[model samples]
Target: MERAEQLFVETVSASLENKSVSWKEPLTLNEWQRIFYLAESHHVLPMVYETVFRCDAVKKTMQKESRNLLQFYKRMTMNLVMLQTIKTQEYLELVQFLQKKGIWMLTVKGIICRELYPKPDYRISGDEDILVDKTQFEKCHKALLEFGMKPVKKGINIGTEYEVSYMKSGSPLYIEVHKSLFSPESEVYGDFNRFFMRSAENPARILVEGTEIFTLDYTEHLFYLICHAYKHFLHSGFGMRQVCDIIMYSNMYGEKINWQLLLGWSREIHGEFFAAALFKIGKKYLIFDEKKACFPEEWRKIKVDESLLLRDILDAGVYGYEGRERRHSSNLTLNEVSRQWNGERKNPVLQTIFPSLKSMKNEFAFLKKIPFLLPAAWLIRILRYEKEMRKNAHKNVTDALKIGNQRIELMRKYKIIE
Candidate 1:
């Protein structure tokens, strides 16, 4: 890590752990600006602001030299309060409406995750995720539209195994009704069925704005969080905000969760290696307390390539935006096929060439209105996105595959995957 980032991490760790941060000398304006930018990118600016308020040296330096940063902090605090208020109200209304419709919705992440923060507003959330049963998905979706939430045309899903997003007309809250937690290509895709079943059996009811709503049970939620982070790690990258969520969640429900059960579940989903690495990172960077849960001695001690891991985390700035580079058309297509046709991996290229009927229709929504013109629409869709598909086709294949191979090798080295 760069020196400024290292210092930012150290300062955040001290603040989140409720320890005093004693800087040898007051930070320069430029150094403080860099720290602020890094914290913002990682979605930890509020937490950093709290630390700044607590430290006499930092507070004095900010007041004397970084007036703009202090003003930014003040503005952030105001916006945080307003946004939290809006989300809380929206959460209550959405829950009431869903309950009336008899839709089994289990809230995940977003405001629900923020409840685990030191201050509810410290962890900023852009959207609300509510998991609904596949059986009632259509009904729930229709109800959301009726309740004033309109769907965004693209980006949430390219296939069925993903969430559908909705936004209110004049509100900032973007709500996603999740049919499956992750995309088909994600490592944790196989575990969605098990998680859904678990959610049905052991629902966690949380009180939001005087109304009660359900969320994932502690163990399942923790495992999901790990898998969620791992998904980002593999694809683009994720930031410290995600890491902080895992640590805060673990700390909040230490004894309530059965670590053995979670570990076994993670292994069943091929997530044991990744989970262990995440826990180790959490401990090192977020200062996760060892007493929270009984982590496996061997897993905890599993050596990690810090340089590589940190690079992935930092590059995935605030929800995988920073490190999103285009891939070759063939690589992208192959990846999609492997994800969607997990059982038929022996011939991914062939499977991709002849996609399933439902998949084809969904990709070309025009087919829904004109069934007989499906083939033409399919051709049109490919033609429309062809330029996008071949964006990085000129890059050397070896270079494109190198990064993926390095990630796989690292995972193997840590025994995260076979």
Candidate 2:
């Protein structure tokens, strides 16, 4: 690991473990900047800033060297905390509203995971995820619209899309109402939805600030998180925040979680190796304690390249939005999954140039209503690509191809794909 990244891991580990950070060496301003940027990219700036501020050594160094940067970081973290506070209240209200409308909503991810942190507000989620039954999806959608949230996109329906997103014009509260946990249209992971079939029937209730909210049970919730992370890993990649979620969730509810059942489910999806690797990475670098972590006995024999996995996670940022070139590169691995599902291996470049009609329809929703517009949509897409490739496109494409091929090998190494 690079010095900055190593320091980042150390700082985050200390913060999450509720221990004080001890900086051994004074870092240059550039080094501090890099560390901060990494925290920002990984969406853990609040946690990082909290630990750094609490550390006298790092605090004194930043104060002596650059007071303005320190203040800026403080202000940024405070604003995020404030926004999160408001969002949390709004989310609870939305859940209550849905219940009044006779729609049963089960909250997921951010809302549930945040409570496990030392400071719940530090783990900021970009949006809220709530799962509703497909039968009640339309009613839930109507209720959200009635609650003054506007749909972020058009033509999204339960038949084709797994979730529909909404956002209020003047609020930080964005919502995603999911009819299914995973997209049924997904070629590689369409079967993942089967795991959550009975989720709503026996939902778990969690108390958030004196209000009771529903979520998946311990076993199913943890499995859902793992599956969610694996889904992203197969495409782009997920960042440390995701890893941290696994660590925190497992640590808090390790005893309650059904490790044997979880392991079996993971194996059914061919994600056991990936899941084991996550736990290994957490225990090795992120202060995750396997002794108390109630994992299956067989997991002890599983081996994974933690360094490679960590490197990929850091480079990918949160949900693999680190760089345009990197996102483009990840498409190659996604294409490999497409090939496996369809049982055809086409040239990557050719496939990119001429995507299937279904793929084109996803990009240009109009093509779904008027299939005849596909030709025009293809031409428009090519023109847009040409326009985007005006500067250093050749080098970018070369880099993407190289990185994508390397990541495919990484996927094989982790047994994500056969």
Candidate 3:
């Protein structure tokens, strides 16, 4: 790894472990900039900033570096903490409102994982993810609208999509109400939904700021974290924040988790090696202690190149939003996975130009009601893409294809594809 990236990993790992960074050399301005950008992109800026300030070396380096950058970090971190506080209160209120309306919601990912952190507000989340019973989806939808939250996509409801997003006007509080844990339309991860079919029926309640909220059971929640990371990995990539979530969750509930059962579920999804690699990465760089971790002996047998996976995760950033080309390249890799699973080879370019009706239904919800409008929708989508990427369309596509091929090779190395 490059020096900046190495320092970033060390700093973040130290922060998560509640330890001081052990860097001896003073970081140059450029090095600090790169490290800060990496922390920002990976959505761990607050944690990194907090940990770095506690280090004597970083403090000396900061005295020599530009103070403006330091101030920027301070401002951003404070804003994030404030936003997180507001969102948490809003989430508690919404949960209470939903409970009164006879809606059973299981909070997942964002809020649940946030509490596991040292400073809950340090872990910034874009939105709240809640899983509700399919039968109670309409009631949940109504409750959200009644709570002054508007649907992000108009006309989104049960049977139309796996999840519906809502945003409150004049506020940063966004909530994603999921009818199923994973989208059934997803060719690769659709099966993941089956694992959580009974999750809402028997959930574990936890208190957040004196308000009780429901969440998945310990084992299932940890498995969901792995599956969530795997989903992002197949798409583009997932960053260190996700890895930290796994580490923290494991640390808190290591003794309570059913490691064998988790392994079985992971193997069912062909994610055993990937899951093992994540834990391995955690132990190696993030101060995750395997001796105390409740992983099975089988995980040690799983051979995966941790460095390659770590590099990919760092490059991809949070949910692969770091680069446009990388996001576009994900189409090729995803298609390759589908082909391997379903024994069908789809030309990624053709698939992009002419998406299936089900795929088009997502962006053009009207297609669900009027199937005949697909051609018009396709044309509109193509026009939109053209307008957005008119200047570098060809170059971007070429680079995406090149990167896609490289990622496919990486997938093979990781045993995700053959």
Candidate 4:
């Protein structure tokens, strides 16, 4: 079994066994191996463990029977080791550089993921998800440049940190510097007041080897997780790390989170049910203070399988599908549409029909209620759109149509479409 995979199991077992783990040290090899076995027996190897570990270790440990699990992690950005080193080192540098620049940023996911394992080496990550005060983001970005860092994308590509992403390569690590915490696509994301009003001011935290790692208060973290999970799930599915994120974070900081705080954040984010479902799932795998919990009817209604679906889909997006192009267009591809669907920009008059966030959010709400209905609706829409697509699919479609009889002859001759 791979070390990180083993660590995931141990982390979960630590939760199950009610043990605490330290993520900055190495454990005995036996401890690592047994934990992987535990995670495997629980059937969470690929979906759960794959999120935090690097791929080479998977190859190093689980060679035969662990093939599928190994492959899955490889595809999901096999740069956990590189990410960790970069994050800790970059953060240390960023802290110093920003102090000189008089800018302060908080570390988010980078340290949180590592904190879940017995040592940073046992788990893996790809980026340092950091959050900075929106007002100071530009200054922070500027400060980063002085330290030889740059943002990963521009103009709404989105990063985990305030501005997000600066790379140095042949080296591992992508730093996601976020301006805000939630996904930009979320319904309330643009409303600064809403986030601030519901945000936790100075939540309880854990110290990892003297570095202060901050997280949402128990209730607050629950709120953020629910909103985030639902936000991602609505987009595709929640990434697998999200599930573990809720599991691990909630477990690690269970005492500080509370139900009322969760309710406030969820309502603010308009993800009340999402937060509830995540809380319900968290409770199953870990223990929380019952006195502080406010399990609702909705929470009990959410199935674990749904959570897993959200996790898998979300992880795929973060990690991306490498061989999708080679896999011939399947029924799902032709029928079900996503943001990645094929289409070209046309003149503005026609371009107004381009799908917008409102339409996507509406679709997301509909799917949550009748989750299986999306495929049929998508198929119907595909058949309707296919006609439009043929014209847009090729610049020649319209030109070819002008040839009249010759076009039909060629259509038949080429078998372009029945």
Best by lDDT: 3
Residues 140-189 of candidate 1 have per-residue lDDT tens digits of 88788788888876443324545677888888778877777764333225
- Candidate 1 stretches greater than 4 Å from native: 15-20, 57-65, 154-162, 184-191, 294-307, 326-405, 416-418
Candidate 2 Cα errors over 4 Å, as ranges? 62-65, 154-160
Q: What lDDT would each prediction earn against the true structure? A: 0.67, 0.83, 0.84, 0.47
Report model 1's TM-score to 2 decimal places: 0.78
- Which stretches in model 4 have alpha-carbon errors above 4 Å? 1-86, 153-162, 183-193, 197-205, 213-218, 267-270, 285-353, 356-418
TM-score per candidate: 0.78, 0.94, 0.94, 0.54
- Give the residue spans of candidate 3 off by over 4 A: 62-65, 155-159, 345-349, 381-389
Span of 10 residues, lowest total lDDT, candidate 2 = 57-66
Task: Kindly list the per-residue Cα lDDT of model 3 for residues 61-90, writing each as its tens digit.
Answer: 655454567778889988888988998888
Candidate 4 residue-wise lDDT at 10: 43
Query: Looking at model 2, how many pairs of residues clash?
Result: 0
Error of 2 at 257 (Å): 1.8
**Number of the candidate with higher TM-score, 1 or 2:** 2
